[model samples]
Target: MIEIDSRAFGNKIKNIRNSKHFSLRQVSNQSKDETGVAISPSYWSLVERGKRNIPKPQTLKRIAKGLRVDESDVFRMAGLEAPTEATNLTRITSSEMVSVPIIGEIACGEPITAIENVSGHMLLPNNLVKGGDYFILKCIGKSMEPTIMNDSNVLVRAQPDVENGQIAAVLLDDDTTATLKRIKKTKNSVILMPDNPDFEPIVLNEDKPGRIIGVVKMEMKMF
Candidate 1:
């Protein structure tokens, strides 16, 4: 097994994060908002400063996306030449922080308010969850299965809008309901799609009415 010095790995990640002109919080936010994974600014700071080593493959993928590089790059920076070495872990803190649950989005059949009532859930270990601003949500159906599995935990942010091709939590004109779906906006209308093939598409006439909450940050599953 290849030994990865935590400090060296942290330094490389820090260098890339800085070169990208992105703050630790900023990257953490994006990971939660776009990919449905969560990370904190403080932990990211430590990871970049060579004070920590990452062990999860999913997390590496999120960091890779956040950094706009291939997944292998994260390993290379961490001083690992193989995927197996990436699993060797280390920590910066003894006590782990908590990440709350977020459960709302486009194509989601549940009421938005229903998901909000859940209390602050301290799940992922400090080493795994990474410290940051994040919330978790429950997935109801299989429309997003294979992409987002049923009974999965999704992380989300609170924002008023999103760009094209991003998954969002949308509120239809029906005041009592909400849906979680991927959105594509055109000049005439908004296209709402379900990740699964069994479902049909929903078109929102821009001239009519609709609301967009934040984008989907992360999707997690518990075995």
Candidate 2:
């Protein structure tokens, strides 16, 4: 079995949280809401600061869920093998399947779509996502946690627009980065809402430069 250094593991967790812009309190709250586990902000802070040792398997699982990250990654960071469910989901038979391109990361700060972003491909079971053109993107932030999840691979169907309250991948004014958020349209503006309360809603004027790249059809958890 691989051995994980305690301090290194702690740093890893902290980095993941920072990348998602999730505060310790937010992670704790979301974990409790999603998994019925109560992890206090103080305790999580200790773990992140390397003052406390890594928790047990069950506790680690709760932390992973709370952070909207792969539980298996957490397990590995702690020098443990991932659970069967986490390890087995990606193994699919070739029959009745289609290859979906797994694009590079989509930034929440700005939105962009281009051919240079292609990273690799994933074979997905057919009937999972039905649409005109479909691709996959690795979610990079906690803004949509408890719904889309950070680091989760989301299946997107190419479309210019989506109904209100629907989640979509969008490009901001610069169109150099991309973000995934729930669309809320008003008379004068469009609001991108994050499922995590810690994040403030992004309001864009109706006339602002932006476009919906695609609607999220499905999510494939990565561990």
Candidate 1 lDDT trough over 10 residues, lowest sum: 104-113
Whole-model lDDT per candidate: 0.64, 0.78
lDDT tens readout by residue for model 1, 1-223: 3577878777777788789886676576555524355677777777776666565666676677556576778867655564553464545353564555544442344444345444445455554455334556566776664456566666656567888877776677754345668888788888888876798878888565777755676665443
Query: For model 2, which pairs clash?
Result: 110-177, 110-178, 111-177, 111-178, 112-177, 112-178
Model 2 agreement with the true structure over 175-195: per-residue lDDT tens digits: 656789999998988899998
Clashes of each: 25, 6
Candidate 2 regions exceeding 4 Å error are 1-95, 105-114
TM for candidate 1 is: 0.47
Error of 1 at 165 (Å): 1.4
